[model samples]
Target: MHRMLSYAKGLLWLALCALFFSFSLLLPASAAVEGGYTIDLTPLLDALMPSLLGGVSLLASMVLAWLLRLLARYTGVVLDEKHRKTLHEIVVSRLQQIVTDSYEGNRSAFRISTKSEVVAELAGYAARKAPGAIRHFKLDQNGLEEFVAGRVGAKTLARLKSSPKHAPARLPPKPAR
Candidate 1:
């Protein structure tokens, strides 16, 4: 549906452009003279046609590209939710791996695409491992690196090291009726 809409919009724009171009070509090739100033319509049209058409095409392409980007972002969010749900343990392990690698000066393990996701996952782990300590301080990339390396503070690190690796169980299912 979205692709069809985008294609329909493009076709509409093309039709409008064609109509304008044909209309322009139908105009009489007359020169207007006012005192010492003179303007030749043919020359003006010849100079402007390519530029105008190119500008219109560029505008249409930019709009289409923007629409595609929005659609991808929406779909990506839905897929990310499903991925997280189905692979919760794997995600936790990956988050830990990234954090550990980052602490060891290999920050490239969590590049731009997954930077925010890594941060969010690591924050969850921290919150679980140290219930209240992580909330007391801001944890940006650097802070997370420090926290992962037991450099944030001894108390927090102690709690984290002693805490169980597994996430706490969510609420149990209600009794089956």
Candidate 2:
């Protein structure tokens, strides 16, 4: 439908151009020159007008096309930023739940600390800091979950269970005296 409308508009413009061409012929001719041929500058001026306007229109369309492309590109960037922020919040919340559950040994009492303002601050901090440490943290939740699960399986996690917030460092054995 749009293509048809554009074609119709082009045809109308062409008809108008033809009418203008014929109208120029009716313009009063200037006095006859030495060669006994009358030269009318009106038709020449009329002929130049369409070409000049077409050039200006072409330039205007090009500028508009560039502006439209730029708008689309920036709009996509903004939407992606918004989506990232929302996803960051979700990931932070999920991670906080998992951490709280694992630390408390069960789902019970998990919400007690999580409901606090301090938990929110901590979640926001992890969301910002952890993404840089884990390359695909923001892009994939399953990947992040697997990563956390893997870390939980490490020896440090067992030590954390016994020690809570403090894990004592293991020193190397001294050589026999």
Candidate 3:
């Protein structure tokens, strides 16, 4: 839609320029002499055509350059978004793997490890695995730590809920009528 609007604007500008150029050609090229007026078509056509052509060419070039700039900017924004999304997915998958590995099926070990320790370990792993992504996304240490901590907290809660020890006990059967 934006591209279409740009093309439309360029066409509108060209049409306006063409209209102005044609009108300019129709204007009288006359000089006042003593008790008379002299019209010279040759000199008028020679001078006017070159300047008009130059003006139209300049306008066209400017419009083309503007359109090119817009296109480049749009492409850059699209690429940046794609890169950021890929980086996010990589980080999330790495974080999940680190959490699962640290679990090791031992509740005691999971409980003993501090949130900060887990974050540090995950951060190191992510840096090793996706250094370019971290830099491109501009993810700072604090942000990475917070993200790891949040995911870890959620995972811990989910593990606790799924564990048999935390599951609701079955109620005894109701007394016979």
**Number of the predicted model whose TM-score against the real structure is largest:** 3
Candidate 2 clashes: the total is: 0
Per-residue lDDT for 120 in model 2?
48
Lowest lDDT block of 10, candidate 1? 27-36
- lDDT scores of the candidates, listed in order: 0.54, 0.53, 0.62
Q: Which candidate comes out best when scored by lDDT?
A: 3
Off by over 4 Å in 3: 1-10, 17-86, 98-114, 136-143, 150-157, 160-177
Superposition error at 31 for model 2 (Å):
16
Ranking by lDDT: 3, 1, 2
Candidate numbers sorted by TM-score from highest down:
3, 1, 2
Backbone-clash count (model 3): 0
Report lDDT (Cα) of residue 33, candidate 3. 44
Error of 3 at 68 (Å): 11
lDDT of 1 at 13: 85
Cα lDDT tens digits, model 3, 1-177, are: 588567657766876886786566545433244438655557756766786687668667767877887897877876667666765566577655544544444343233245576667666666677677677767798876665566567565455335454234446899999
